[model samples]
Target chain A: MADTSHGAAPGAESAPGMPQLDFSTFPNQIFWLVVTLVILYLILSRVALPRIATVLAERQGAIQRDLDKAEELKRTAQDAEDAYNKALADARSQASEIVAEAKADIQKDLDKAIAKADAEIAAKAAESEKAIQAIRDSAAKSVAEVAQTATADIVNAVMPNAADAKSIKAAVTARLKG
Target chain B: MATEEAGNGFNIHPMDQFEIKSLFGGGPIEWYSFTNATLWMGFAILAVVLLLVVGTRKRAIVPSRSQSVAEMMYGFIHKMIEDVAGKEGLKFFPYIFTLFIFILVSNFLGLLPTSFTTTSHIAVTAMLAMAVFVAVTVLGFYKNGMKFLGLFWVSSAPLALRPILAVIELISYFVRPVSHSIRLAGNVMAGHAVIKVFAGFAGALGVWAALPILSITAVYGLEVLVAGIQAYVFTILTCVYLNDALHPSH
Candidate 1:
């Protein structure tokens, strides 16, 4: 009994090949494990995990917000461009309209100037015809007077007793008429 | 075995490092005694706190490197929980996050020479697994009441086979915790053990020890991957279990 007990005691006291199989230290191992694990869990849930989650959340929120802002800004830029293009188109149309109006105005002024020039030319032509007619009438009267004087003078010189002044003048006038 | 001799003047004790003793010199370990496990766990917690709290103290919009790392870890697990278990599962984010970070930091720390691998112990992993199992089970019951048992009832199966399918499902349901815990502990322990064995060989075959040493380096790199992957697997599984608990129809 003594030898068996001694053998058993040594077997029990000496460590097992696998320390895990040794029941003696299981409690200590488990106890610390629990303690440390509890502490870690607390830290995780309360401190570590929350901090990480917050950072991640903040990053995501910031990214999404920035993206939305960028989208809004992009839309604004597009709208601005559209507005600019519209304004440009409006300005271009207005400019074209103004050009058309100016062209019409210039054409109207040119036509008026042309009409005034034509009237001036027509009036000058009428005046010029009157001056020519006046000259022609003066020449015809002078010619009639010259022919009577000449006829009277010629009859008196060449045929002294042939005819009287009145007869001669009448003869000359008839001949000129003929 | 503590040490082995391979027909030469070399002695190796690959398993000695796993021994649990009082961190404050050797003595009988009481139930509440501080140990290497506790020390490493404390370190793991400190690492987590430092990364999560202090690193993000400034909370700069343009984060610093440490803050980026903290945020990356935060987002990684956050997305994972949401992806695997949906938005409702985010309610358990703290618990799952704690498990993941603790396991992850512990695994990486374990890679350090002479450092204790807290997760390599069945006790530690089993504790985590049981906690998940119990939480999910309670949540399942609370959410679905007796309908939670419908998880094991195969309605699509033939009428004659439904009961057998239900039994199988029930068995698997109960086996979740066992498999969950063993998967982590076994993988961690095996990797560490293999490294230790190679180390032992390197010491035994002094001149030709370069081969084992090179292998240890390779396995160490693999262990780093395993560490991260195991942590991910654990958290994802937790999320899956939470999913089933929340919706226990199938």
Candidate 2:
């Protein structure tokens, strides 16, 4: 390092005043600047900048691809859910229809069974009425016969042949008629 | 420490650090001479290459720390160029990025205990600013032809005042390069000089030098901040000037 140890030289001399204002060193500074700056420009434009740009673009692309995949999966899930709902609705409607048909069939069978019961009861009642009529006739006949026998016995005991049997029979018949 | 003080023992040569001499030996500086300026300038380039090229050699999907840093710088400069200069101006991004990185690296490297601050020199900054000025002027003409001069003419003004406004605009336009160069160089130089002055105080103050040491630390921190800011300012101004070239009427 060339220290400027020598006291400040006169302004007219070789290295005097502000070294910055000194024109002698201007070329050296400018030349290197141009060289260094040009090289830096080349490196930045051609080598460095492109690498950074590529990394950023790659990251962005990866993110976009993942998002698209996720969206597709979400859409598939939604479709499956929609299909399940449709199947569930169909099953509900089918179940109700089967229940309605089963109810109609059971109702018809019940109505048929009730009609058969009513016909059987009517036939049994007719036969029971016929039996009651027969009994009543028999009972009337027995009563008449008994009355005739009693009259004959009484007449015989009281008088031997005085009273006619024909008269007694006719009297009994009139009483019964009255 | 002994060399910093003069015979009087209270002297401080804050400006001595800026002196440039040949690396080989003391002699008259030739146009082709390799000096301390050239050495630090080389270091600046090497730093940029190490960070940008070697760091990104793998080009991994998951970047290492160095790669991320490189990518961040790339993106930042890229966005800055696009934002200030419009999309068309991005064609010049390489040049602008080079300028920014070199200056920024040079400024930070200079913060090293004995390192030279290349950006602090007017010759370097002037060259850069003039390069921008020349390139933009050429690009403006190349793109818009005679219409590029419309940057100077303000059509919205009253007809009588248009010419006066154009003169003022022209003067400002010409002043752009001077201001651009000086802004970076001047900021860097001032910060360095202040630190040097404080360091001198620290030397002279001896046992009670803690005060100047603290001030130096604070000023050094500010200088680091200024270094980055000046680089940003320089690059963004370049973009703005390029924008004017691209859309002269605007």
Candidate 3:
């Protein structure tokens, strides 16, 4: 390859033995390389790096905030549940108190009604006893009257001249006593 | 020259693609001559701006697909520097990131057909490696003072073997930039050159071109992997070197 290149192009040839070994192009490559590196470094440090750092930090902060909000909401829900349970317990105790008060009132009313009925029954029994005593007394009196009359009639029929109302009455009364 | 031999026999000029020609017209390449190298470097810059700047313009908390991609790249390099170079090295994050994005974009761009691979040139890789080397050395002295020399001295070895170990360490330390620069250039150049050679075979071989085409396809896939891996390797090595400068204990 060297002999062929030498025989073909004599001096100031375009293609060398190896293009990489070409000293003439080194300055240009190095110059552009330095320029490129400087440009890249400036852009990266100034604009790109800081921007990415900020974005990453912002994402992290946003995630943290979301988690904190979730925790707060959970705590609020728990507080509400506790309050509801407390209210439920309070209402139950109040209902039981109302029921006890109603039971006491009904018991008082029942006792009063029973006492009044007993008093009425006792008064009616006393009145009936008194009337019964009065009827018995009337019946005894009539019996005595009838007996006296019968005896007097009998005597008058037997002995007409000796029959007197006062005498007969006295005799019948003495015989009855004996 | 290979074009001159095309009429006679098989024509294969794999190195021709690497030639640095003036973009405007044919002339002696001045230091400021806008060549293909300048144009491709400009493309790399445009790619960086589009991805890191325009893509992240929304700055969405829940990132869009392109925005997420940009963030992922940022996080990957950020974490890498933190892990390898320690927290103090985060100060150089933009510098290291610039190197990484440039090399990465340039490698992928070079994989395109008829594109000139800027990183395949020693001139470009050497500048990158030397920049890292000089910066790291200066940082080592600035941070550690004269104690930076302790990085070469093997305190763990036997008393008698310390000198030999120190000499070896010194030599290895000096060779870092050379190996660093050459490794990237060599890998990129080798892959592109191999594909070009295979492509040349596919062109020359009349009826049996299928075999070379198959080889080209397989190699093309490998080259894609190499493109990403080489950029990663370069960045990670830079971090490791920076770590040595920052710590310099061993």
Candidate 4:
């Protein structure tokens, strides 16, 4: 291929030389390179970089906001829990007070009922005692009347001849007295 | 040349791939004429637009695949500049990002079969390195005035050795652009040329073509890694140079 290179001609078009060494193409390559670099720089600086930076910043802000919201919700939950505990404590106290009051009222009612029963028992016992006394007085009077009648009948049977009723009654009374 | 003689049994033009041709038809490569270089550079620009501009059109907080790639490139370059060049260097983020994306996309595009590798050209990489060199030098002087010259003077050295160290530093400083440009172009050009040569061997050794083909595959994979690494190296070097400009103390 080296010998076939069209007879040692200078700057021959058919020569397979290193194109990078070709100084003639430098201006073209450099020019396009500048154009490309400038265009790339403009696009990046003006549009792409700013956009990406903004997106990243916005994402950071969104994350922070979500964290704050979560914290607030947790606080609210804590507050709700505290309130529930307080309400539970208050209800328990109120129930105990109700129970104490009910106990006191029941104790007062029991004392009143016992006092009324005791007074009724006392009145019934007094009435029975008065009736027993009346019965005893009446029995004693009947016994005395029966004794006088038996003594009068016995005297009449034993002494039939003595016929004066006033005299016999006087004699029986005197003998009984003696 | 000896490879050319050895390949006398079969025709192989490995260097032919680097030849610049007019995109339209046969014509002299004029300064403004559209060539394959321009076409591929245009493709690189279109890729940049598609990836950075069009892909991020939604501006989503949770990015899609293409948008994620765009953001990753953005974040990668951003952190690199900040780390190497410090906070004030963030002002030059767009310029550094442009160089990175252009070179990266161009290198990857060149890996496509029959696609031209623009970064493989000394003209292109030299231009890029020269631009960085010129920009950083001007920024150094502008930001520090005459103090920028202190970069070459090693104050930490012994007094007797200072002048010699400064001379060495000065020489190295001037050679930066040359090495920077040549490193990228050389690595890219060599990889592509080797692949082409191996492909030619596959054609010549028809029955035992699998050997060259396998070598080509392995080289191509390494080339893929080189593609990304070269781009990273170029960008980071630019950052280091920019840092020297901004600080210039050590």
C-alpha DockQ of every model? 0.53, 0.47, 0.53, 0.48
Candidate 1 has an lDDT of 0.87
Evaluated at residue B33, the lDDT of candidate 3 is 97
lDDT of 1 by residue, B45-102 (tens): 8888899999999877778988899899989999999998999999888889999999
Off by over 4 Å in 4: A1-17, A111-178, B2-8
What tens-digit string does per-residue lDDT give for candidate 2 at B44-102?
88998899889988887778999899888888998998898889988887788889899
lDDT of 4 at A172: 57
| lDDT of each residue in B1-250, candidate 3, tens digit only | 5555577576887777888989887688999999999999999999899999999999999998878988998999999999999999999999999999999999999999999899999999999999999999999999999999999998888999999999999999999999999999999999998998888888889889999999999999999999999999999999999999999997
**lDDT leaderboard ranking:** 3, 4, 1, 2
Pairs of residues clashing in candidate 2: none
Question: Could you give the CAPRI-style class of model 4?
Answer: acceptable
True contacts kept of each: 0.72, 0.77, 0.78, 0.73
Q: Mind giving the per-residue lDDT tens digits that candidate 4 earns over B117-210?
A: 9999998999999999999999999999999999999999999999999999999999999999999999999999999999988998989999
RMSD for each model, in Å, please? 4.3, 5.0, 5.3, 5.8
Model 1, span A1-178: residue lDDT tens? 2332332325555532555677778888889889888988888889988998888788888889999999999999999999999999999999999999999999999999999999999999999999999999899778878988887788778987787878777876788689
Pick by TM-score: which candidate is best? 1
The ten-residue window of minimal lDDT in model 3 chain A covers A1-10
> Against the hidden reference, what TM-scores do the models get?
0.85, 0.81, 0.82, 0.81
- The global Cα lDDT (0 to 1) of model 2 is 0.86
Interface RMSD, one decimal, each candidate: 1.4, 2.4, 1.2, 1.6
